[model samples]
Target: MGKITGFLDYPRLGETSEAPAQRRKHWREFIRHLGDADASTQAARCMDCGIPFCHNGCPVNNLIPDFNELVHQQDWRRALEVLHSTNNFPEFTGRICPAPCESACTLNINSEAVGIKSIEHKIIDKGWEEGWVTAQPAARPSGKSVAVVGSGPAGLAAAQQLARAGHAVTVFEKSDRIGGLLRYGIPDFKLDKMLIDRRVEQLRGEGVQFRTGVFVGDAGAGSAYDKVETIAPEQLKQDFDAVVIAGGAETPRDLPVPGRELNGVHFAMDFLPQQNKVVAGDRLDRQILATAKNVVVIGGGDTGSDCVGTSNRHGAASVTQFELLPQPPLQENKPLVWPYWPIRLRTSSSHEEGCQRDWAVATKCFNDDGAGNVCSLTAVRLEWKDGRMAEIAGSEFEVPAGLVLLAMGFVSPLQHVLDAFGVEKDARGNARAGTDDYRTSVDRVFAAGDMRRGQSLVVWAIREGRQCARAVDEYLMGGSLLPR
Candidate 1:
């Protein structure tokens, strides 16, 4: 520990964010990173716990205490090195990750946890400012080729690792751009796209090839982008020695209520990508705008919060979020759930942006006003008894909802790609591949990220990508020097 008594001296200090009203005017990052001195002070709060549960808490197994000590000692360069050692894109996780590591911090047992994510955010930002992040090409070529199918965090991490390990790596994206979900699904206000662009440039300099607008399976009507080029699964298997299925789980769950086919109802993925395209200056034939409309976002997760934020940015007449489950406690029972992710109410920056929220309410149907477009939503309040929910009597109500965004989360990877490659699937419909090997049933085929494990956080995606890259490298070269 850099400072033995620092934990007692310092309180947790989170990053400051712009007021919701001011930030909703434009699409850009609103959270301000902690200054060097404040970050060091925060890092110094990392106590010398006998066991660092934050190591296990972090999906990529980040060396939390080591980096904290480095930052506290004011060794910015070493801190960056420690950060990049495990995770390929700390910039992404630093901004979007929920910081489970902080929940698992030892000090959190009785006091505020160390501000790990905020410190990480500052470290990476400083690393970029000092030009410490750059290209690292392999000294020699291994003459092996790997095809990573997807350009999300997982695919990018796997591609970067494989390329640095002396393997030729080409990442194919179904969308017109390189980043899959990171560039599209997420709203720009949370993460600036320039950060992704900077990493893309670095990867290009390191001999990684990015093939955008190329779908690796049947360009089916469901989730494939417009004007995408189709490449058969067999084509990739034939061209490359190994194929890694890093394509994310894009199959969204549907709400099959009456009038779901109405004009104003859309999946979150469909609605989110268009805003991102517009932010990037692309002209859309038709844009889904929430401006001056009564917007209703369904779901209680981060995706739902993003919709609320985006709607607020669009100057919607009103924004309302509905969560099917009952609200959680304001404070977690830390003694019962210490060193683990606790069940507690989490209020994101978006939730603070003037959106009305209701819990334990289920949408009954979308109401139409003579026209084909949706006008309002009918819902009912529910009460839970023995883990079963029952509608409360006389609690039915209707709210104006000219626009409805379904943020219910993704169910599985698009089945077309899995079917095209003939990869076996688990009960959950994700590709059947064990974490130890990450090899699919098909020979020379591997899976990782949301494709293997179901829809998950960006941190888990990076962890899977790194481990899958190691497995693929070992399979190709009989051994791998890359970390798991």
Candidate 2:
């Protein structure tokens, strides 16, 4: 609440980006941060609504109104303090989160909402610039230990909160690097990996131990797997005060049609991680080059966008993305969908690079050339009737594709890891853990993140991790000062 009339006086102005042509040339963050004047004007748009629905919209329950007022007053330091009181990594949420709180803003009912995400980004960025972000490492150790499996936003948030709550926290990551999806699945241009590295450094300085390339169980552990440490659920139950499972939902969706096994077909995960490793200096005997090859991406989510970006970086001949459902309206019916994510045709930055996007399309089959490589792809158009897709007759077509990347998302966490730990699973196949308590069936063993919530946003994962940390602390020592 800056000025009583600020909502009417100010219009929303968020961050801008460099020209798409220039940004696509290299893997680097391209967002142009809003200036103090711009940010303050945007913050002024947060109206004096008695009931701030933005709180419910934000998974971390950030005190958004107070921060808006402070930002309007140009009080960056206090704003960050209030922001950090609930969220462990405001800097992270600011950068990658989809900002549901903005949709729920009072002004969004009729006018453009306050640029909440932009203000959040500016607040945390200014805090770090002013060196206000530092390690508090708890006043004293509680002599408790927590093993958090996964180094994504959720795992990192949980580990940081538990460590700050005076518990010894160790985070385990199966990949060679940290930041599960954030590190490898996402392209560097959207979120420069350096941000993650800097946060990891802060967590390290705060006494959180991170062991990368360490498997929690046999799910991802191949025969030649070397464990930095073995973690049996039984042992974790006995040795540590509590164990929190925050591993990702890594089981990728696959296509089962004919010729799928051909050389050119691959999953989005299979293609994405390899490019990430190559960027990190890992040598590839034969690069998975998309250069001058006609490429097709299946699924129209963020992962597909990443495939598009990486393919452009690889200098592809052309890129096409297919989605099964009908195309959404360019603009959402905001009056009906206000305070909730709306159905709209969301175009990503990758699409700006270049992509032929088609919705209401279903992949019929993959046809292979005699040499056992994908040659032609067939698709059929669909019509939505009674809330389901009905294929349109004679609307079939084929495209010449040298490569196809499946980005259809994941179904569940790997079965073996859940099986090995003997944790009960929900109907949806995620580890069964309640948000109210975050406890799995196994005593003192909690679960969080994608491993528990199914495929979700990075911000939700961070919220679960923080809440799980508070739950573990409560279980270990009668109650917790940690924020839930």
In terms of lDDT, which candidate is strongest? 1
- What are the per-residue Cα lDDT tens digits for candidate 2 across 1-484? 5588988877777689988788778888888678888888888888899999899999889999999999999999999999998887777778778899988887888888888888999998898889998877788889989888889988999999999889988888878898888887877777777788888989998899988877777644453245455566676667778889898888889889888899999999888878877877789776677899999999999899989999998899999999987899998888899889878898888999899999989998898888999987999999988988899999999988999999998999877788878989999899998898899988788999998999998889988988888888888899988878
RMSD from true fold, candidate 1: 1.0
How high a TM-score does candidate 1 get? 0.99
Off by over 4 Å in 1: 221-226
Give the candidate number with the greatest TM-score.
Answer: 1
Residue 375 CA displacement from its true place in model 2, Å = 2.0
Give the runs in model 2 whose Cα sits over 4 Å from its true position.
Answer: 220-230
TM, every model: 0.99, 0.96
List the RMSD of every prediction in angstroms. 1.0, 1.7
**Clash tally for model 1:** 0
Q: On residues 358-420, what C-alpha lDDT tens digit does candidate 1 reach at each position?
A: 999999999998999999999999999888999999999999999999999999998888999
- How far off is residue 276 in model 1, in Å? 0.5
